[model samples]
Structures are given as C-alpha cells and as structure tokens.
Target: MTLDYRWLHDTVRDRFDSDDAMEAFLPRPLTPDELKQQGDDRYLSAMSQRVFRAGMKHSVVDAKWPAFEEAFWGFDPEKLVLLSPEQIDGYMNNDRIIRHRTKLQTIPRNAQFILDIRQEQGTSFGEFIANWPSADIIGLWNLLSKRGARLGGRSAAGFLRLVGKDTFLLTSDVVARLMAAGVIDQTPASQRDRQRVQDAFNALQRVSARPLCQLSAMISLSINPRGGLKFQTQRY
Candidate 1:
C-alpha cells in the first residue's frame, strides 16, 4: 500500500503550534562521519546503559554512568572481557553502581560480543554501525539482539538510537501512525512486521529526503504530541 506522506506531513505540522516547536520535536541524528568516529568503548558503555535502562528510570541510569565507566575500566572491551565471574558477582557489594547482579553479569558477556565483532570485522564498533545500511536496519537490530546480552527488542533499538544511529523508533505513537498509514496491522513485534515497518520508512525516506530519526519523531508527532511507551514481551 502507498503511504500518504502529504497527510503525515500536514498532520504533524498541524499538531505543533509553530515551526520552531515542530523543529524542536524532531530528532537530530549523528552524521555518518560522526557515527564512525565514536570509540568502541563508548558503544559498549551505551549498550550496557541501554540494558540497565530497561524497567528503570533513564535519569538514574544516566546519573550513575560515570561510576559505571570508572567501574568497568572505561568500558574497554578487552578489560571487561577479562573480568572473572567472582569479580562480576562481587559488584553486589559496590554502592557506586546499580548493584544488580544479573544485569552486571551481562557486562563481560557483551564485552565478548563486542570483541568478537571487532575481531570479525576488524573495525571499531562505531564503524561497523556507521557502515550498516539504514535501509536494512532491522537486520542490524536482529544481529545485536542475537549477539549482545539483554539487547533484545527495544533494547537493541534503544542502543542504536543512543549511539545516534539514523533509524526509526517503534514508539507507541510511531507504531500507531504506521498502522494508520496501512504500514502494519499491529505493533511490530515480529520480524515480518518489523520488515514491513522498515519498508515503509524507506518509502517515506525516498520522498522526504529526511533521515530516519527525524522521520520517526515526525511520524509519532503526527498522531500525538507524545506517546506512551509499551515494551514488547517478545523480541522483534
């Protein structure tokens, strides 16, 4: 089915009180050059942050991230991969961080994931992300979900967004907009639905020439000023 970009644009534009307001609501994603320049350690840090961020307040997680960086040796994959299980379990005694043992355990595992990618691709994690085709971004999400610890579903997408990847968010409002546009019948909780959502974004991009980040925010705003978040029980 063909999407109505005109309707989407007009609806979003109508929702906002002014041009400045509309622009402020849009997301500013990192350029390819900027995305590639970020260090692998930062990616690891972001991945960990995104994991802990689930079912918790982002502000609390963000507030303690500096301690996490210091605690995890600046999130260097090599250093983290070397952490012994006892050392991982020992984080429970530390008050500087969240102190959740289950979540903390993912650090080493995800570090190994990062290392494997580095060794396999022979590039910084940022370069790997930057080089990924945004048109097939769902594939990237799937890969992250499969390889990284606790990086399933929105967590995978959240990590990508945290790192300024140019991909659309499947927020509640965005999904509603997509459904209304005949893009999908329901929340994109399956790979099949996700592919459809991706295809729709690609179609929208072809006409708008806007990055996925901005388009996603616009699509969400088209339906509502702000939408409630709903995490899926199953990974897409």
Candidate 2:
C-alpha cells in the first residue's frame, strides 16, 4: 500500500505541537545525546553558546554576558575599542582567537555604535538588552546584508534564532529534523536551510497557530537524529 503522505505530514505536525507529545513520540531529546557523544570540547562550546543565547533572550543580566563583557573589557565602545591599525597587524600574529583583521578593526567601532545607541535610547544596559529587538529572519537579513556580514541570509537568521531571537521560524538543525521526520522532501540544502525549515514550520502554522519558538524546538527535537541538533557554537 502506498503511504499517505498527507497523513504522515499531519501526524508529524501534530506531534510537534507539544513537548509532551514530542517526548511521547520520541524517547529523549534527539540532538543532545548525539552532541554529548561528540566529545568534551565540542559539547562544551555548543552548550556555552546555547546558554549564552538563552541568557541574552531572557534578559539575564548576570549570566554568561557579564563574563563576556569582562573578558572583552566591558565591550564598551570606548573602553574595549577595536584594535588600531598597528594593533591589527600585531593581532595577525597573536593566537588568542580567530583573527579576522577587518572585524577586529570594526569591533571598537561597533562597540561605540552600540554605546551610542544605548545612550541615545536613554536606557540602562540591562534595560537596553531586555528591550533589544528580536532578531527575526527578515530583520537580521537586512541588518547583516547592510553590514556585509559573512554568512548568507538563512545562515544569519539561524544564528540569530540560536542566539535567542524568536523571530525566525526555523534553523538548520531543525530543517534536518523535519527531513528526517518525512514531513518535507529534501531539496538542494544550502545556507538557506533555515528558510526551508521555516517554510515547513509556516505550513504547520496553518494547522495549529502557536509561537514560533515553541513549534520550532518541538519539531527540531522530534526530527533530530540520535545525535543532538547542531547549533552554531562560536560567536566570532
């Protein structure tokens, strides 16, 4: 007998509506186990990014961000300013972090801009963070495109979503999960994998209207391989 694709799709969609349903459908969260299997360094980095992003989203002022700020010298535009041209040349030889000469140079300027925006808005740093705009797919695409950000549109969207912006509907690992679940046929997987994931997610919206993050996480966990979902671990 031919499998009813529509029924299969609907079943998958229904299961993704609730974590309880998802857990009932699958024994455990799909991706975490796989990630744990990867090894300490990889797992730790991935967990760190996830935790950092979550803190950023919830406006947890005293979390990983404090450490990040302290390490980067307050991320103050003036205080942790970008490296000078001479300093940039020296950074090329330093082995501290990935040395993107241009980005390193832009860091101070970006910090300054962030500071200016904070001051102009007349908000405390914590408030500014709490009220920061959700980096939805379209907004992030526009923002990154204007700045010539390294990643493509979908990749940027995924990164922003991973960082706690709930605006985007889907992410790369989520898309992989969907494909695994047989909810959607695989097409040319590209940097825009997040968009594909979002498309499937939006299709489900027609059935059960709900928050995007809740839906995305449910769908992702459902379809994720035995290995955990792959999230972008590094910021720089």
Candidate 3:
C-alpha cells in the first residue's frame, strides 16, 4: 500500500549514470496558477501534436508544427470551431501540414470541445483543466474522452501530460511493475482495472507526496536489469 521514496530514487539512480537524468526523469509540472493562465490555443496545439505523434516520428511531427500553426489559424478554439466541413476536408491535400484528414478533422472538433467547456463551466478552458482535481485524474480523462473527438483513452492521457497536468501513464513498463507489485493481474483493459490502477497511484501519492508521473517512471525503472532505462527518457 506504500512505496518507499528512497528505494524508487536509488533504483533509478543505480541505472542512469548521468547524475542529472533521474532528477529530470519527469518534467516539472506547472503550478495550478500556471495551468490556469495558459491560453486555449496552446492546449489545442498540444492536443493536435499528441494526435500527430501517435502515428509519426516525434522529430517529423515537430518539424511540421510551424505549418500546422499557420494552417490551423494558431489553434484558436473559437476560430477553429467555425471552420466549414469543406474547409476541413480541403486540408487533405495540403503539404504544409500533416495530410491525414481524420487528424486534421480533430482540430475543429476538439476546438469546439474546448469552447463548450469554457461556456458550460463559466471559466477559461485552462481554468477548467486547472480546477480538475489531480486525485481524480481518471475522471478528467473520462470527461475529455466523452467530450473531445479523438481524445479517448491514451489520447486523453497524452493531452493531459502535454499540458503539464499531474497524472500517470499506464505504459507497458509501468503495467509490468504494477502487476509485479500485485496492483493488477494484467494490462488494465477494463474500466474496473483502470480504476484499481488509479486507486493504487492515489494511495501511493498519499503516502509518498510525489508526482504521479515520477511514480510511474520509478515503476518503469523498477523492473529487470539495472540499465534498462538507457533509452527510456520521457520528454516534456
């Protein structure tokens, strides 16, 4: 029910010889105020980027971001939400941005999702995301999936992580450790198992007072040989 911070720290430190690697294992998430202050455009850009990252190389996707910014009108939720169906369809042949029509379509659909949350909640989209409780991050994930197009499951989780939210990723390595720790029997394919995993991280957070992402990384590095994380650095 409890994870030893010392053990997690030492476990990772023993593997990565660079003294700074463990210290930088996970990016420093923004404070609530910082989260609240971000523009919705940034959120849209980050969300769209995650969608592109799903099927392409990070370097390739990143290199095209400048064109994406231009093509999507700087990811302005209000503006994007108003794009015509024909206008969205028109991007299918555009070389300036990723030509995948479905991914291009998420731009306008997710833009509307952001605006809806702002109007319904009577706060900025950033504020709405910032106000979400970290302990109930799964709840936030569910909300995003239910409301935003192409944001279900892992896409929702990736978006949250990109926006500097405090949450854990159920990566393969983390799942392996979760199984080893008796948290679950296998990959959390069912909602019930996912909830159980969230509860486990919630408990560990209560005990260790650590960020969930860091805990996930620690769990990832906790398995197998000491040098397992040589190529596993997570970028912010």
Best by TM-score: 1
Maximum-lDDT candidate:
1
lDDT of 2 at 98: 38
List, residue by residue over 1-236, the lDDT tens digit for candidate 1: 64677887887788667878767667777988999899888899999999999999888998999998888889989888898989977888889999988899899899899889989999887889999999999999999999999999788889998888887778887888788878898898998999998998899899989888888877766776543333221111
For model 1, what is the error of residue 10's alpha carbon versus the real structure, in angstroms, after optimal superposition? 1.4
Candidate 3: Cα lDDT at 91: 85
Query: Could you estimate the TM-score for every candidate?
Result: 0.92, 0.47, 0.90
Q: Supply the TM-score for candidate 3.
A: 0.90
Tens digit of lDDT per residue, candidate 3, span 1-236?
A: 43566676687678776768666654466788999999999999998998888867877998999999998888999899888879977888688888987888888888988998889999999999988988888889888888888888687888888888887887778888788777789898788888888988888788778888777777777774435445433331
Candidates' lDDT values, in order? 0.84, 0.43, 0.80
Give the residue spans of candidate 1 off by over 4 A: 226-236
Runs off by more than 4 Å, candidate 3: 1-6, 16-21, 224-236
lDDT score of residue 30 within candidate 2: 20
- The lowest-lDDT stretch of 10 consecutive residues in candidate 1 is 227-236
Location of the lowest summed lDDT over 10 successive residues in candidate 2: 39-48
- For every model in order, what is the number of clashing pairs? 0, 9, 0
